[model samples]
Target: MHLFADMLARVHAAAAAVLGPSADLTRIVVEPPRDPSHGDMATNAAMVLAKDAGQKPRDLAEAIAAKLLADAKVEKVDIAGPGFINLTLKGEVWPDALRTVLEQGKGYGRGTVGAGKKVNVEYVSANPTGPLHVGHGRGAVFGDALASLLVAAGYSVTREYYINDAGAQVDVLARSAFLRYREALGEDIGEIPEGLYPGDYLKECGAELAADYGDRLKAMPEAEWLPIVRLRATDMMMAEIRNDLARLRIVPEVFFSERSLIEGELPDPFSKEPPKPLVDVVAETIAALREAGHVYEGRLPPPKSGNLEDWEDREQTLFRSTEFGDDVDRPLLKSDGSYTYFATDIAYHKSKFDRGFADMIDVWGADHGGYVKRMQAAVKAVSGGKGQLDIKLVQLVRLLRNGEPVKMSKRAGDYITLREVVDEVGKDAVRFDMLYRKNDAVLDFDLAKVIEQSKDNPVFYVQYGHARGKSIFRTAAEQGVLPADPAALQRADLVRLTDSGELSIIRKLALYPRMLEAAALAHEPHRIAFYLYELASEFHAQWTRGGKESPHLRFIIQDDPQTTQARLALVQGIVTVLASGLDLLGVEAPEEMR
Candidate 1:
């Protein structure tokens, strides 16, 4: 069903016949002609291979064209200026392409580009200290959509969430909750400390603790009560986060805790009978890197950016990150002998490799942009170049209401929660708007605009396309257009779909499989959103044109049952693709807009 891919394979075969088997066909691409008058599809096989073929580009193009014309599907092959070969397929090909869409239905665009490769996508790994904010929503939607896209492209994807629970931030969360706990016990705790969390969300956690353990936790010292409170507060916050993620319909398969990397001991993998002494993964990672000459005792120069508070003119345990393309050798341990964040991160990624994942993707917030290179370097060191780490940094989401900045949440105090946005505008609007732009680019999410049922609102426009398609089928059945069933519709005379507007819809449908494969390969789910909008615009325009034009151009023709059925098949094709694309983006394709 990938028309471009199929044509590209034929083009490659023609090139091999002319230039012989040793020719490199990797650079050649088959794509739709930019100018419709040029041809249906265009290829640059001759231009790319001319120099190595010892021939003029035009001469090579002519030879390739001759070979291509021999194929039954190719009606004409024209060599353009300097040797870009444009192909025009037979008239029947478009109807056959439409047939492919009708027959395949929901399976139309499923591709094998990934070839079942195992890929681990870790996204929305927000700290469990608080509720997820709008910024985290962008990462969540991007990561989840990318995972779904990869799955559609035939990749075995594992959705993961790395919980950042082993930091000083959680301690602050516990202290904040303890204050609220004291308040729960009818004690006056005035003014939250400046360093502690200020969000009112922790009040519920405080109330929960008070309900469970009463004043028992109040009697213990900070050392004794801190662990209990931290554990309880982190669990409560994480539960809230899970609830919020559910609001967005996102469920990550694994929630890997960062604390587990350093706190727990793993049984030696090499030992059998009675297991050897449990090994610390963080320490083991350091030792492995040391043995591999990737770790060393070194002193680092002052940083080129940010504060030098952590920098010292003393020897420290360091990873030779610069050797693997980092900006500098990274410290593995703090001055107090505890492992640094980078060290624990190295162990965590190493654990991913140990768990049969050689391909790892981490979806990070904009603030972690600078952390990419060192983490990539660590993956290389730990996996010994056998692993690949692709880090996608999702930029900030600027929330607005009718072009003005939106206010912060009362619950979160300083930021708006993801749950608030989802609840207000619905997850479909939040997700589609978030992914309608590229991940690396800053996205402006307008609250008032998203809910507007206008073409300007992409979420509504695209969903309406599906809704409109279903409406066409309903109208057809009411008008008593015979052969409304899918099987009979598939048998409709599709060659009657010779109108330019009808063919345009089929062409766009033909591009879905190719566009999906490209989007999956590029790790950009926004491409799907963009394609959906264009497809919807095309469908809407054609429908409007039919309304204004003669009755024969309409989707439901009263006198001509054949054309109506063919048009019905086209609508079915559009609905199938719209639903499939929406599913990949984690949005719903409704039968009706209301």
Candidate 2:
């Protein structure tokens, strides 16, 4: 159904026949020309094939153009600047493309780009200590959209969230909840002590504790009270995190707990038999790695930025990450006999690989950029070079209001939560605007601009296109010109859609499948956002032109029901594609936003 791909296949065959079937065709790329006047599509095959064919580039271009002109799809072929061959397809081919779009509908952009490979996407693995902030929201949205994109490209995807419940952060959470519990018992707890969370969200945990146990836990020792409070608070915080994710339309297929990795015999709460702990499983994997010479005792230098005042130079259990291209070896254990964060991460990734995931993608914050090389090296070590790990670092978002930066104090309570952003501008605006730029580049999310109901706002522009398309259907219904059924619209005389404005929209619609494949293969969901904006721009421009020049060319026609149905079919195609793209980004395709 992709005209571009079909045209490229014909060119590939012709080029192979001319080059005597031995030429390498890997570098051949057929894409839409930057300038529409160049042609419907352009290819640099002649230039790429010239050196191998031992001929001047233009000579090869003319030769290839002669072969392409013989194909029925190529109505005209022009040799442009620097041996670029531009092919203008026949007009009839475009209506067929629209027919394909209507026939496929939601499945229009589906492609087998990934070839059914198993990919594991680990994202939003926030610590079970508190609510997710705006930073975590970016990663969550990026990762979830990436997963959906891969699925659209025919890859089996596992959406996963890693719970950091086995770390010092959870311990801190335990202490903080214990303080709140004391306060709930009417104890006048002074200013929150150091090394404990001070967020007001913890008051509910204290209240729940007070309701469950009147004074039974008041006299308990720290050892007994700490575990109970930690478990209870972690559970509550994770539930809150899940709800927050739901608000943003992100749901993970798997929630891997870090605490499950420790070695112990514990009864399964739902079953009678005791299950083996994950710590033993990780230890066994480490032993296998050690047998393969990837683990050893080593000392690591202190990190460059953070203050490590308690730093003691000593050899510790380390992963041989340096052998696999890491800058330095990483320690698995700290001096106090506790596992470092890297250790648990390594175990978690190893578990993913053991589950038969050879392709893994990790979405982390920009601050974790330094850890990418080591994590990749660990994956190579544990998987014995059979697995690949791709780490995507999402840069920090600078929130702005009315052109001024919003200052957030992590130590104080003056920070914005993900829920706040979602509530203020709405989930659709937040998701689309967050993903409208490249993930590696810092994004300036201006609150005022996103919420503005104007064409200058891209979120509104694209959604307005969808709404306008639906509005055409409403207008047709009001004029007694609505299509009797979807099939009637599908079978509308699309040949009537031959005007420049109508054909341009069809051309944009035709690019969706190929665009999806490219965006998915590149692991860039932002490309979809950018494409939606451009498509909406095309649709809106055409609508505005029709308003001034030819009102009959507009979507609805009261005088001619057949033309109205055909035009409505075109509008339906636009709406289908916009909705599909927005769905991949987890954004809403709003019918009305005013």
Candidate maximizing TM-score: 1
- Please report how far candidate 1 places residue 248 from its true position, in Å: 1.1
Segments in model 1 whose C-alpha atoms lie over 4 Å from true places: 22-27, 47-59, 80-83, 265-279, 304-310, 482-484
TM-score of 1: 0.95
Question: What is the per-residue lDDT of model 1 for residues 246-341, given as tens digits with 9 covering 90 to 100?
Answer: 888899999998877776423322237574454468998899999999999979999888679878989999999998899999999888898888
lDDT of each: 0.90, 0.86
Q: Clashes per prediction? A: 0, 3
Clash count, predicted structure 2: 3
Model 2 TM-score (2 dp): 0.92
Q: What TM-score goes with each of the models?
A: 0.95, 0.92
lDDT of 2 by residue, 324-409 (tens): 99987777777788778888778888999999999999999999998999999999988889999999999998899989987664
Model 2, residue 2: C-alpha shift (Å): 2.1
Judge candidate 1 against the unseen true structure and give its global Cα lDDT, from 0 to 1. 0.90
